[model samples]
Target: MTATRTSSLRIAVAQLNPVVGDIAGNLAKARAARKEAAGQGADLVLFTELFIAGYPPEDLILKPAFVKACEEAVDALVADTADGGPAIAIGTPLKRSSGLHNGLVVADAGERLAERFKIDLPNYGEFDEKRVFQAGPEIQGPVGVRGVRIGFPICEDIWGDLGICETLAESGAEILLVPNGSPYYRGKVDIRQQVVVRQVVESGLPILYANQLGGQDELVFDGASFALQADRSLAFQAPQFEEGLFLTVWERNGEEWRCVEAPVGAIPQAEEADYSACMLGLRDYVDKNGFRDVVLGLSGGIDSAICAALAVDALGADRVRTLMMPYRYTSKDSLRDAEDCARALGIRHDTVAIAEPVEGFTEALSRLFAGTETGVTEENLQSRARGTILMAVSNKFGSMVVTTGNKSEMSVGYATLYGDMNGGFNPIKDLYKMQVYALSRWRNAHLPKGALGPLGEVIPRNIIDKAPSAELRPDQTDQDSLPPYPVLDDILECLVEGEMGVDEIVARGHDRELVHRIEHLLYIAEYKRRQAAPGVKITRKNFGRDRRYPITNRFRDRS
Candidate 1:
């Protein structure tokens, strides 16, 4: 159907967070957002993709009851539009006669205006939409809202080579309103902007990109919703790592439509964005999963110190608890640093000596290891003791344990399997060792807005400046086993994110033998990473869903 040309349109982008499988809660949020948009004199309110059912519902869409609930929720919202204050466009799963599909329902004037299914289903990286959703067969037409023709292309439809936006534009779509459930990774904002700009340039129509916010499982969507004019100019921009209902006023000048009243929100960059993404991811994961509190073992090192600070920032200091499980090799500096960090953050701190348990485990295993040397296995006992102590505290206090292994350790198997890897979540799983140190320094320098911790430095300076150590043995440092963080992180970034070959990495001023060894360690650590707890993903590739490698694979980059 062709939509009549309008002189002006005010669209509200509801970039809100929704919980997966909570249809009732999601519907309530949608209703509230619609009401707020109506109050702001918006002609239409646009929600992110799958806002009713939540983004990346994963296998939850396979359950008949869940899909029914989502449909019912959409029905309620459709019925609520009878007031005619503002039209509603929401994402949900529609069970058609053909199959189940990811769909958008456009409702206006007490009736269903149109339904558009997603044409392209992404199945790469962390997305598995094709596994559960059937792609729409053909391109859908634009929906008319207050005399404006607005195209509704779901997330992946515009990201792929489907030409959905071009087809819609050819069919008289005046403005593109794309809803996305896009997750956050480092430098994703720029990529999304470029994608929207390309679509706008191709269609010669303004595009409004709305993305979901909050964390689900390992994915965290940074809601940096924005609008782009046909001239490839960013007309409006919403803040990242926040949830809100933003409004933009558009007016047609002659034959072209432009956003007349654009509100450009501040967009964070680099480490700031990465830190906020991690904090939001951890906060949403803990809050949505109904965790009362979180506990972690602070080893007076950079990793644990920053993790403790992050937990306190994500969940208030009242909700964070720190424990120092010092062993025989634990130095006084570690104890002092841990105490200083806890005091700085104003969180509860305790000390639990692991000497008893370490000695007990050593004695118990001495008989079996009569002929073996006391080296790595013995060192792991200390970590296992600390892990057990943290779990015990968590169980006794009904708090979840937060693991504190950065991406560098996880990449090279520098962590113990059942020890440091044991936790409900890790905030820095996607960040390398150097990134961890950088974030620690950033946290100390500036207190990010919306942080629940104190304004001053929460991570002790000593923790940031001192050498990192697991304290499993006497005078041990991370560099003793693994390469320096600067070198290791560069090599890892090349191998993981850059996907560079060993020779290519060696050409970048790295030793060929060292590159090969690091490659081997990275490959061998896959099994340990597979068993590690879920963490925030701040990079283009993370260990869990972003990078998948078989444990039994024998192929190596020998070239």
Candidate 2:
């Protein structure tokens, strides 16, 4: 391949959301994006990895029919380019004589120009690509389009030590274009920038990174797509958690290709980004799963309140239904707070008393528990009753139940198994208790721009001001059984995310006994975590896909 000196080139980055297995819908999106890019005078348009089949299509590629459907979708898009529109470099899975491969196909003017397979297939930590996709045989050279030689590396190809970028550069590639389905974790944007900068510095060529934007099950792609010049300077940046077609201009200066400066969209960080990720994840899950409405028990506690707010923000107030399941242990203040929150959010609020069901269960189990004392088992009855009621409503109304257990509670097994933990999905499963409080405060301070809820404080101040409790028994609070949220969250973070030993955690100003107890709880709770509903992953190591542990393990980190 020889590098051709082209004067100018315009590339449109389609950072759009795609639904898994929705081949026809995804094809329509691709066609519309190409038409828009053509109108903007773009020379080419780049889409994220596996846009047709959606990212992490998981086991769907194994089905011959599914793979055939994806190929048909790609063919349809290729046929649409006969009108002399901008060329397309889109991601799709291809079935070849060798094996199935995660591939990128370039199409222009009713002709397929080049097909490049992903060189690296990631298999660890939320990715199982190696199980499905076969790695490309060898490093291929760049493809020339309109006098410019461009290299296409699918997601994970450039993240390894395979020297894909270096190989392309050595083959006279002028620019590197990477299509990614990179999921959003905390501070992932910085990590991506660093990765791209390293590749650019090594290849001495401008790199454009286009990432998918949407929530696919437990994964949320932030789509903070950006371009880096060879000098490590940013050329353009698309906003995170948004779906759009952004145009970037490139011009040849002397012998090098450089991206022209364009509008750089503002990107949120820290809590704002985490909140946005949760919103997008929930919204996409609800929308993509074809649920018309969602139901959650708003207990006037911080976790449930914040989840309700998120539900309304993701799916508008009209689509959310809050049920307050009050029992003998439920306080007057909680009922009032729940009502206030529902009123502020403009959602329907109803009260379903659990006393009858609780008593009914107690009566049924009285003979079996003749000698047993009424203790934790009885308290769990209240929870199970509430869970059953919520499930009944979900079944009757055809709405999904949203569980509301935070990371701290989940880490220590503080949540009941089939009781408070019974739901289809959880919006805040990855958030720690402290993070939940902070997000609630931040939400009260300012409504996110795309939030569907009202402008004022949707989560009442009293809810944030009150003590955190499950309210399963008389005067019971969360601290009655566990440590303070701040201390517990810090210790769990060290244990779960940091993977620090007991001594190391205690050295960080925590008591030795407390650290050991928390560590024990964290380890024992793996069974429960394994059974919990899937939620958005906002941190580096969430319970579900990011961190995997054996439920029957006996080894403990005594050190």
- Give TM per candidate: 0.98, 0.98
When summed lDDT is taken over every stretch of 10 residues in candidate 2, the lowest stretch is: 1-10
Off by over 4 Å in 2: 1-5
Question: Candidate 1: which stretches are off by over 4 Å?
Answer: 1-4
Please list the C-alpha lDDT of all candidates, in the order they appear.
0.90, 0.91
Q: What is the overall TM-score of model 1 with all chains considered together?
A: 0.98
lDDT of 2 by residue, 49-74 (tens): 99999988999999999999999989
Clashing residue pairs for model 1: none
Q: What is the lDDT of residue 113 in candidate 1?
A: 91
